[model samples]
Target chain A: MAEFDKNMDFPELDAYFSKTSEAADDRMALLELLKRGAVAYRGTEELRKKCLNARELLPKEYRYLEFAGLQKLIEKCKIFDLKNYSRELIKCIIIGVCYYTLFQSIAASAVIFILCLIVMVGGGYMTHRKNAKKLETYYNLAVELRGVFPELELEEDYCSEEKLMSLYDIVQANELTSLESAVVKLKAIG
Target chain B: MGKEIQWLSFKTREQKQADLDEYTRWVFKYGQPQKEKVEQILSRLFPKEAPSMAMMTYLLGRDAYYGRYNTKKSSDRNPIKDMYDVLSKKRYQVPKKDIPLYMALIIADERVSEALDYPPDDVLHVVAARLMEQE
Candidate 1:
């Protein structure tokens, strides 16, 4: 399928649609995935609002970088996890614990390390890193925004801390496929 | 109270409150720390649980400038709210419905100035509002 290979940007999302069956089980699974995406999309909207508010209030020193990071996050929020590589992720974690347990045996530990790497790499750990990088840029931008109002934040009732920290955590804690779920949810809703 | 009269009064009060809220939201938004500072001082000066009325907004505009224009010479308190107790006086009582527009004029007036305590100048949206207000 040369045509399919050319068009499929997200191989993980492709896995979901590759199945031929329109069976109830598959339909339910898609719905569940879409629901996760919807939740992630809401998170994305909150982040976008923070970006806009900070962009407005603060000087433009970090505007380009902040906006760029925010743009990547917005895009990611639309495409995160679609293949459900969570099982593989869990396996990698288990193997990691075992690898540590057997680290005294260098040869065996190296083999285990290789296995873990293969599993993690296959499970879209690269995508996680890409997303994490985007999140770091946004966090840096937020720091710049916070720098603008150092004294104001010291007040007890100010909500800026909540806005910065909660949004950063939302971006950081989201699953790799969180955006994919959001895209599917939007499509289903539409 | 009669049902019709009570309902009308309630509606009027709600509409007035909504207008005040909208006006304050605008000031808070564009005015930045100056407006926020004014709000903080006013909230402290009043320290009442009563719902916001036009007097509070008017007092903030009338006082809270850098210096002068106050009965008190202490130099710390907002003159309009602290010296005059403008809200307590009956003549200064702005009609409920007119509070928002009235306060807008006061906050945005050319004579009023934002305190220079914070940096970057132009804390109050006075110049912007004056230009927009064409005054």
Candidate 2:
């Protein structure tokens, strides 16, 4: 709970920890070592044991540099802009209802409106849910890839929202082949 | 009686890797694409330092939450409240003070920063926000 010594000079602390064996007592020094990606501490047995203990004392998320690094990347992703999505969906339903009221009888419009609402909400929810799930999977894969290939720089391969959106569209387009197959079967039967 | 402090727990390695096979399949299905557009935008907006997209999003979300677009009064803005709103939207349960510390830890961590390499005037924005709370 100690405030980061606001004046804590990085270069000076780096020098201090690099030279002294007393770094094990300093949480910041342990963090410095973790920052250096020098997890395998090559030091005196007492220093190494103490450093290990210090690492254990640090937040678990900070303990593994890879997780911390990958997490930084995953955090970049905007899985679902839920607020924007709901706002747009509501605006759309309002407009659709107004159009229906102008064009149809009240009883018919009410039935149609209820059906449209269900379809719009259910369909929107499913699509967003799928996209969110896909993005989460993508993030987890990025995280796990760090462990399997520590040398790999995941930032270079990070997916963007635009790319993912386009890819999802392409995947959906490809999925239409199943519908095509069913149509061909029906045509032959007819 | 003194209050007991409970430290945060980490995910177990086994739990972490449990669905690696499924994850690999998913990643392969989606395919990894380089975020060149994001890089371009970040480079243009923050020519000096790389503020992670997460940081950028948090700042933007904070502004949106405050209806900054509609308000002209500087007194109406509250950075601490905005920060909490953004964190809550993400469902994070971190302590307010720890939030800045966590940001500083990641920003200063060399290995992590290397992965997040870009540019930031936004870095100053982050530091300023933290210092604002300190004062």
C-alpha root-mean-square deviation, each candidate: 26.5, 31.7
For A1-190, candidate 1 gives per-residue lDDT tens digits of 0011111132322232233223324444544543443343443444445755544543354334433356565455445563546677567667766777867665776677668757665547555655456555555555454344432221111224343333333333332223334334434544
TM-score of 1: 0.18
- Over 4 Å off in model 2, which ranges? A1-85, A148-190, B1-135
- After best superposition, candidate 2 residue A187: deviation in angstroms? 54
Model 2 / residue B64 / CA error / Å: 71
- Output the TM-score of candidate 2: 0.23
Docking class of 2: incorrect
Q: What is the TM-score of chain A in candidate 2?
A: 0.33
Q: Output DockQ, candidate 2.
A: 0.01
DockQ of every candidate structure: 0.01, 0.01
Docking class of 1: incorrect
Predicted model with the maximum DockQ: 2
Q: Between which residue pairs do clashes occur in model 2? A: B48-B120, B49-B119, B49-B120, B50-B119, B50-B120
Name the regions of candidate 1 deviating beyond 4 angstroms. Answer: A1-117, A121-124, A154-190, B1-135
